[model samples]
Target chain A: MIYQTVIGLEVHLQLSTKTKAFCGCIIDFGRAPNTCVCPICLGFPGTLPVYNKEALNSAIKVALAFNCQIQEHTKFDRKNYFYPDLPKNYQISQYDLPLSRNGYLYIYRDNKPKRIGITRIHLEEDAGKLIHEDGQSLVDFNRAGIPLIEIVSEPDLFSPQEAFDYLTNLKSIIEYLDVSDCDMEKGSLRCDANISLRKAGSLELGVKTELKNMNSFKGVKDALSFEVGRQAELLDRGGDMVQETRLWDAEKGVTVSMRTKEGAKDYRYFPDPDLTRFHINQDMIERLRLKLPELPQEKLQRFMKEYSLSEYDAKILVSSKEDARFSEECIRIYPGKDKKLMVNWLIGPLLSEANSRKVKISELNITNDELISLIGFVERGEISGLSAKGVLSQMIDSGKSARELIIESNLLQVSDTEELSKIIESVILENTKSVDDFRSGKTNALMFLVGQVMKKSSGKANPKIVGQLLSRRLTDA
Target chain B: MAIDNETIRHVAHLARIDLQAKELERLHVQLHEILGFIDKISNLNIEDVLPASHILPISNVLREDIPHTSLTPERALENAPSKKGNFFSVPKIIE
Candidate 1:
């Protein structure tokens, strides 16, 4: 009895506007509790609510990027609920009509794009934070009234890894838009999944459970995997499915039922009286669409075609907007060089350095000009690839360019054919046994002789010339 | 379209308002009268008309994206029922 897994995600992204959604209060993530609040955000009497135009603009940019159709008339609604974190009894959100809908984000699977349907993207106000310590809970109102957009996806994902891929692509698109930071650790982006399991090839769907509180993208994948297995086992054992919301206990690594349908909250939604409707115009959408940057997928295809980069290298370079821009900058700065070399250094050594330092590649102290100059040294045969790595490490640490670092450290590669030949002759004479082995057709002995030449030259001699001169000297002998 | 006693009690419970039995009975009648008055509009054939959420003719009421000075922690927490330091304290939530 094989089963199929169906998944959909509702992601909440906090827009990085300077002010709160409906008020003029400052929006800061880690500020002191209750500090970033004003009368309007605090839900005080006589404080009329006004929408933030910047938030609406960011939402439109994201919606357009996801290929959603912006509704001509969108309005805010009040979702009534009782929670300690919500300063107001109701959260101003969208109901019946959202800002945008029917968008699709294409994720690459098996080198082809798979379009995932976006149900809607709506604007809402975030609740405050609740910190429970000892016996009581304390609420921080700083996050309250922050503008958030709920992106609901249709049940198009068939596997947990597909969901992970969808989220990665989605995050990349959002980062490219520059609307939100989308940092999961700081709670700027959060995801919850609705997953159900059905018999393989069956048209009917199983009763699904809504999974909440998955902290990371990997957590989402793992939680959905566990839920699929659990539901499949339950059906195999002839157990009835229960419609409920489950919490992902990350520590226990299991889905625990948070609430059943009996206690389920019915958020009685109604049009919020304080805020008016937003009539999106064609002029505004066209202006933003013109301003939209080249997306990751488009950039990826262009990188492969224009730069002649391998699909693997192009994909890695375009994974982050910063890295993609950095690669382009390097290519632009150092024209007439092998783009493959730049791609290799960026994907290999530069990326590893950034990873070790726990910073973004663009945030590395070295500039693109510095990196291109470093590659230029290698291109001109002034430094070996090995020596260039040493120079790059120092450059990252001390903010120095490649040329300065090479001079200061005297890492210039010794490519002089005369000097290398003299060292190679001495090595052939000193290692007569290896010379005898090379003459006896033990071809690997030539490498040992070349290693001796490099060691005698203090690793400054170019290995390529060293190998060539050593082979020439041995055969001549 | 008419309101019933059971429905009134359920709505009251959902709203977290505890109602006495006599109060529920009285409100049930009053709620039905209000519904009965409003139900007259249902008889009109207004299928082509759009449902209006707001009566105002204006739309797109929005403000600029700028931050003004926020209230101090003291002022923000001033009206809370209970406050501890800079936070609003509440009963421990188990779930």
Candidate 2:
């Protein structure tokens, strides 16, 4: 029997607020243990949380961007648990009412767009880190109290690749909106996946397993792929699936069972009394909607239609906002009026150099104007393409102009017809056997003679003109 | 309403609480009363009403990509109960 895997992702994004969610403590990462903590975040006996306005605004922006229905009146709930990392026995989160709901993100697969529904996006506080030493564990409160927005998606994803694409699109949108860094390595963005397998046509969901501790997008893919196979094997062997939470060991490439799944009643959720409810009017929504910059999808379309770039090229350029901006600047400078040469150079040699140096194109010493000048020089036949590469290298290293490098190296194009004609005539005379072959049916001999003329001129002669003159002289002879 | 002994033990184990048998018996009646009172919510007409998660209509909060200086090794270890050089010290688990 065929089995279909159902997967849902819960992504926790740390908001880029200036302070902690409900406290005035500075929201910073990589700080000393307990250095960023305060009474409010540490959950002191007398400390009361005062919600940060910026955190609320940031959460609203995410809700609106995902097209979720906003809740008019919402409140925070306390989730009770006894974890050492959580200094406060109970975590303040949303229970019955979340900030947004019923949103969708479109994923492109096999040349078709599939809409994945978003269940909810809720706001919460982050917990601290625990570093286990030889005999004991050490707690760091630096990350505690940081505002986090948890976006939960419906179990609409069937394959690992679709989940990967959905995550990529989500990260691109969030980063483009300048909400969170969405850096998985830095823990600014984290994801937990719930997966289950059911009969291909079954309407009921199978016993689900929750996967945690994936550090990267690749980790998520690998973990999900492993779980899918594991579940399918269990069902094939007539083993009953158990509902449990599993931790992904990335190094070992397997999922280990942590504990059995807990029901909703386990948390004992209740409304937090310290905070007050706030409102979001249509005017405020319009203001934020207007402030949104051109998103990746719009930029991709513009790159294809206006710049006449291939789908593959446009996708690569628009994947990162920095790369897209760099490409746009290059096009603005060079204009690509001649054979899309600028685009080729930007994608090829420039990308290679940037990669080799471990830097972005924006960080390169060569300015957009300089690159344009180099392209213009090649287009006008002022310098050969080979010589232009040398000029570009010099421009990157020494910040020199193409014209200056061309003049210094005496590498001007030998476009003078008289000079090139002399070289072409001499090559034709020198290679008589080839010339005779050209007069006959061997067209390749004519190209050999043109190559000889270019070699004699030290690769400075324009190949187009050399070919034309060589064929003209060969036919006349 | 009186709570049963079996129900009290199940709820205690689900909550990871180590409760004595006598204590469970006594708490059963108290829990039953509390749940009986809370059940009044089911009487309200909320079939079509949506549940609320947050009060404010907030979205799209972002931060700029900038790297600030990290905590020094000394400061990072300041809160550790045991320390070895720059790292926190722990018992040896594997031989």
Candidate 3:
């Protein structure tokens, strides 16, 4: 029987706040083991927690961006647990009343926007780090008490790719808003996935397995794929599925059982007495809603409709804020009838070079005007497209103009009809057999002659002019 | 409601506790009392009202892409229970 895989993701994003969630301690990562700790963060006796207003405001902004309905009154709850990483022995999170609910993020898959329902987006304090040594354990409080907002998605995803697309869209929106860095490698953005397999026509959900410890988005995809296969295999053999929480082993590329699933009462969740119930007023919500910039989806549509870019090109450009801004800056500097040329260069050579050097477009020495000038040189046929690549590298390295680099490197295209005619005549004389084949209706031979002319000119010849000249010469013979 | 001995034991095992037999009897009564109070929440008409997940109405908090200083090896290993040179030491498992 064909089975469908149901997937949902819980993404925990560390808010880009300057201080701890409920304390004034500076929220700095990579600090000394206990340096960032204070009475409030360390959970020392006789210390009372005072909530940071900035953290609350930041969480509000994220909730509004996701189009969640803001609650008039909300409070925090203490989740009881006995983990060494949790210094307080209980994490302050939302239980019955979260700040935001009923939100949806629209992700484009296969050229259509798929609305993925967001179950909830709640604010909580992050736990500490546990370093496991030889037969012993140690703790670091640097990340403790940091503010985290966990966004839970409804079980609307159908496949592993949809889950991946949902995550990519979520990351882009969050990064564009300057909320969290959303760097999965750095653990600022963590994800947990719940997957189940049921018959294709079934409406009820099957027993789901929760996957954790996925440090990257690829890990999430691989773990979900593995679980889907594992669950299907079990159902094929007529075996019962166990609902459990599993940890993703990235190296082995499999999900291992961690523990049986627990319900809400297992955590002993209760309203946190140390914190007060806060209210979000209409003015505050309106102000934040107005402050929200054009999100990634809107920007992507504009790139497609207004700029006339391909879906693939627009998606790549709008994936990251830096790349999107860089492309927009290039467009603004070099407005023309053919905008696709600028889009191609921005997505192709520029992105390839940036990836190779492991640097962002902003980090490159090439400015918008330099890129515009480089593309302009190619558009005007002053330099061939192949020669413009060399010019771009030179511009990035030496910070020179495309025009200056063309002159300094002697890369002017052989658009001089007189000079190109000499190279074409030499090619025709040497490759007499190819010329004969061209006359005999071997159309590919004509392209070979054009290539020979381009090779003779060191890729500095205009391909269109060479083709036209070669065809004209072949016909005359 | 009557508290059952088997239900209390299952709850303790689910919570990963090694509760003694005597403690199970006491927990049976306490859990019954707690569930009775929680039953009050089910009585409210929360079907139409949306479930609240977060307390604040915020979205899209982000940080600048600036490379802050990273923890040095010394600071990273300062809290390690065992260390060998610059690396954290772990128990050997392979032969």
Candidate 4:
């Protein structure tokens, strides 16, 4: 059956704050079990939670970066659930009055920007970790009460690929905001997806399943893809799907039914009476807005316009904040009218060098002066392109100037006409048979003589100059 | 507003209050009477008033995001009925 997939993702981003959301417990990961716990986070009776100012600021920064409309008035709610991980049995989260709403994130579709609606972003406290053992489960409260902003997206994604793109772009922007590290392996960024498959062109929506346990963005995409296939197969066999919560078994590469999804009524959400509402003022929003860095989209658009880079090239260059800065720094120092040369090296040899080193391009030890001088050698025909490549590797490795590497490696191209004339004279004397072959209409013999000059110079001789000089000397004499 | 017996049972279950049958019957009558008395406040004319989350006009009660020392694991787990090493042990929950 031809079906259209609808997906909405919920990302829980842990703010890189020093302390917990409602307490001053240090929020360090990989610590001793329950070492970071306190009365406020452990839910001791009569304990009151004080909101973290930095957490609120980080949450607002994320909302502003995504262009979400900040709520004038926002309050926390008690989301009641029966889970051992939740020490309080009720998670303090935002319900009706979230931090912000009605934002959108841009995902690339068919080489054009597609705006995926961001339903809302709310601030909440994370639950604890549960590790199961024989006949018992142990709970660690260290992770509890960490400030987490839940970014919920509208069901604008139509395919698994779009969902992947949405997450990738979302993570990029969040990193640029410097709110969270967006590290999935550290459990700093977690994702849950709700997907439904409806008959193609159907207006009415199909029953959706909420998928969880996706530790990485790729895990979410793969789970969604597998779910789509599972649902489509079931529907084709005339079987209906029930709305449920499923867990992604990344090892098995399949999503298994965990439990029935609870309704909003089961949660019984209510405004948290302990923490009072805060009026998010225009002054605060404007302040955070000023602090927002030039986001991925803004940087990409500017790169295309100012640097004359294609969208593909601009997107690649601006994907990482550091790489974009490195490219821009190189271009700014480049002594040329058209910066395409700088862009080419950035997206070409430099990128390959970075890839081979298993690091970002900016992470390479490439200074602007050295790199520009390296490229300048190739442009002025002073060094052969091959020699420049060798010099570039040395420059990146040694952190030395291009001139230093060139001189140290003896890679300076023999481009001087007078100097090359002497080599050509030697090549003509040594390879007289090839010279005779060339003058007698053996056109290929000219290349043989050029190779002799290159060999005599130990590969420092520029092929273009040697070719030109050898052919000119042979034909003119 | 008339409160139903089922709702009373649901609320008791949600609150984890395991009440006896006689206690449930008696409380159902008392709770309805209480709700009926409180529902009279709805008749007051307050159409011009804005909804308030808190009554004391208090807001923005917060603290700086500075890490402060808290109870050690030994102190934090002092009251736990069951402890496995430093963590609180409970019945194994697979899900």
Q: Number of the top candidate by lDDT?
A: 4
Stretches of candidate 2 above 4 Å error? A259-265, A308-311, A333-366, A386-412, A416-430, A453-459, B4-95
True contacts kept of each: 0.88, 0.09, 0.02, 0.91
TM-score ranking, high to low: 1, 4, 2, 3
* Candidates' chain A TM-scores: 0.96, 0.88, 0.91, 0.91
C-alpha positional error of residue B80 in candidate 2 after TM-score superposition, expressed in Å: 9.4
After superposing candidate 3, which stretches have Cα over 4 Å from the reference? A259-265, A355-365, A397-404, A416-450, A462-477, B1-95
Candidate 1 local lDDT, B1-95, one digit each (tens): 87778789878987889999889888988998899889999899999989888988889999999888888988788778888999999998864
Top of the candidates by TM-score: 1
The model with the greater DockQ, 1 or 3, is: 1
Residues A156-216, candidate 1: write the lDDT tens digits: 9999999999999999999998989899878999999999999899988789999999889
Candidate 2, B3-79: lDDT as tens digits: 77777876677567889867886797789889898788788899997764445444333333322343455655666
Candidate scoring better on DockQ of 1 and 4: 1
Instruction: Compose the digit string of candidate 4's lDDT tens values, residues A94-133.
Output: 9999999999988887888799999999999999998999
**Alpha carbon lDDT of each predicted model:** 0.90, 0.81, 0.82, 0.91
Every model's DockQ, to 2 decimals? Answer: 0.84, 0.16, 0.09, 0.81
RMSD of each: 1.9, 5.2, 6.3, 3.0
By TM-score, the better pick of 1 and 2 is 1
